[model samples]
Target: MKLTHWWPTALNPISNVAFLRPIDGGMKLAMLFQLAIAASAFSLHAIAAARPNIVLIYVDDLGFGDVSCNGAKAISTPNVDRLAARGLRFTDGHCTSATCTPSRYGMLTGEYPWRKKGTGVLPGDAGLIIEPGRATLASILQQSGYRTGVIGKWHLGLGDGTLNWNGKIAPGPLEIGFDECFLIPATGDRVPCVYVENHHVFGLDPNDPIQVDYKNPVGTEPTGREHPELLKMKLTHGHDFTIVNGISRIGYMSGGKSARWVDEDMADVITHRAVDFMERNQAQPFFLYFAYHDIHVPRVPHARFAGKSGMGPRGDAILEMDWCTGQVLDALERLQLTEKTLVIFTSDNGPVLDDGYVDDAVEKLGSHQPSGPYKGGKYSLYEGGTRVPFLVSWPGRIRAGESSALVCQIDFLASLGALTGTDLSQIKTAGDSQNVLPALLGESQIGRQELVEQGGGNQLALRSGNWKFLPAFAPKNAPAKARPLELFDLNQDPGETTNLASQYPERVNEMRQRLEQIQKNP
Candidate 1:
């Protein structure tokens, strides 16, 4: 038997006088016991060393086909491709929702955002959606002796309803278990265009108090609606409000001009900040949630990557995102943490061209399929909307390969909890997260047997094995078109072109009922 195991059994008779006496093999027994104790300590140290430093690279609005590894020829994601080459690349991975806010909420909380009201997209100055003491992904890891930090776009909202941008912001990432945080209060296209490091604005001047208003105009700045000449990028839709760095955002902002971040310099700024976090926490196991704000609305690449991609600003932004990924990977290598780190790359949702501004995303598109073989993109209840790029890499540990495992970001809570040896049974708030660590690490081909996909307007679809079902429902405030239930055998129709609702009525009914039950209970 192993010395570590045998030592514990032999330790039962420690108090016995006969066992302690230096007679016969008693001296040899003492030496063996000392050796066994040393062996046990070494075994424990090895186990602790095995717990890797996790770096989750969550990208925004990046499609499955945007990376070269996923079949994109227009733009190359060498850094993301490098990750796929080193570890398992999931072919059928997904986010919980089609939109950014809900998907992010689902990913962190491990609970379906649709089940909880007020989890939708928030304004620039909305309150904290996540309750302060709830069990979250970061909190779980934090409890497992991991130093947790988040840097980048934190659209999950901050503070209570009455948030003071100039003062300390409470009920934020710090309150929810993150030891460190450097975040954008909302999306880049939103107002209050400043960075929030921990609690206060990064470079806010006390004299220049910040004021933000979404309803009525607050600042005397030129808006996209009034001054079209001031805009460096033109708007195609409703992103016409106060101008902050030659671009009008969704809301109005008055002060904190010194703290305002330049749109072109955002990637560089955040990339450096992320590297610094890793450097500071390299001595121990750290969980860095590096969310990237790239290839999203107002696609403004830095001057270095301005015209790199011939496909315009959107493609250029993709290249920029790839560079950011490279920066993080290079940092890991520099810090000698490559093999000791577990990195996961994925997107919040699918991609959408012309989300708000017109940056030639559609015009310069020359035979580039953003969603690859999927049907829809962004806000629709189709395969393309929620299916995103999911790549995981842990050098020397996770074998390099491809997996068709049916996995979702919602499972990160339980899967990672299992990885860190946290007692998941004690975490009652992990609503729908399942421990899919084996699947995530490429040890198993199967993941979740069924997954729930959410699109815009709280529309949902169900996926069971190779079959997908979409229930019939009329959209709000729209003309009530006679829409029928839809079903597809995904193995045959991955693009979701054929609607087999008429032929398979019984299966549709069963799936619809199952979906309803999940919604009601989950």
Candidate 2:
């Protein structure tokens, strides 16, 4: 179950998992026996040994220029910048999709999100999107002897259709590879705004069942559309539903008042549960997917962080996120897992302002560009919609530096396989996860040759080295494209301002041909 409160700094303790030992008699025999057992139990955990503790710090809707090291001059992200200071900071990292759901699907499954029929941004009450028997990154890591856990935003989907909130939420994260899950059903702007831990909603009163819907309202719960006066933050578009904590959400949820999560304490609540999971499983190597929900919609920063960023709710939420990162880093140090753990810092997609609420994101945006001078925000088919900050730090193995490696989030599974010394050939669907371990370790700059990028739905862009080609999507029911044919040399125009498809017809044709071949073949 999820924790009810945030851990105060005063209560946080230092870790004692030290390798330093003295030349004592009782300890000597114990050490020899322990070493023999460790050697026998596939314990390849020394330097250059088996897999390191993998922590994927996947933040939500964080922009490419959000960190201080990444041209975020308007706001500061010292904690994240410190991570960059200690590890390899990637300049050209991109997510598989421009939005949340599909990108997460690709990241976890190593398969293109569009391949699955209904894999788009899902409603909070939508049924499970993943096939029950599918193998995900978590399942793969599980087989590699890593205890897996996912904490925070799980917008993928929930129970297998006909979700009875009072019953077991099956076909959820547990069915996906996460040993345990402490998650939000969807975004903060969605309904049934409660923490689902493992199977049931934490703190849920069995007496108070939750009724949710997207089409019609629950018939009785007063909604934002009907009562605008109840709202604390006004919605500029969409997002006008049952109001909770004076914020209107996308879906309507009734009852379960005790179970509903407090938005103000969400970051802290999730962090405490994550650290607890780490502490509980510290004896063995574990994989923690610490998905932060900060910097998303309904940008309500905790009281302390409210005025921290001059850039309105967006900036304040980023400040909250930076603090969250610092807290997680502190957890690792306190647990004495700093040297043994490898933290991968990245985002699900690029940033977007006014996603749903009028939180002064656009008005208070100032000269601070969230997309870092890239061309798009949220749904655009441009570099800014996908290119984001990526960092890898493992106090010892990875040296401090910057890498221009053209890597995608989908490659993480394969890199972990190599790090754990696991046989990838034994795992199916992991074929899309190419081993970019060398790139991740700052050892090599060579990355995948071709990568498939999705905009909203079925909108595809093929990136081969420096040239990116956006072919006319011809599928009958595909999302409409604004441009017929577009091409750019990212090396020349990383902002994607100039289209070179007409200038370099031969390169365009070559890239189009290659894209079709990979799609048809893969």
Q: Per-residue lDDT for 42 in model 2?
A: 43
lDDT of 2 at 328: 85
Candidates in order have lDDT scores of 0.87, 0.82
For each predicted model, how many residue pairs clash, with residues at least 3 apart or on different chains? 0, 1
Cα lDDT of model 2 overall? 0.82
Q: Estimate each model's TM-score.
A: 0.90, 0.89
TM-score of 2: 0.89
lDDT of 1 by residue, 421-497 (tens): 67667666666887667678786686777889998868889998889999886756674642567999999999999
Candidate 2 per-residue C-alpha lDDT over 1-522 given as tens digits, one digit per residue, 9 for 90 to 100 = 322222111100011011233343464566675675466334323432646788999999998987888988899999999889999998878888999998898899877787778899998888888776777878878877889999999998998878988779888999988899999889999998898999998888988888898887884777888888989888888888899989988878898989998889999999888899889988898999999998899899899999778888889999999998998899989999998899999998889987878888889988898888677867766787778889999887788999988888987776676677665565566456676666787866766667888887778888888888998655556556446789988888988888888899999888889888877764
What is the alpha-carbon lDDT of model 1 when measured against the actual structure? Answer: 0.87
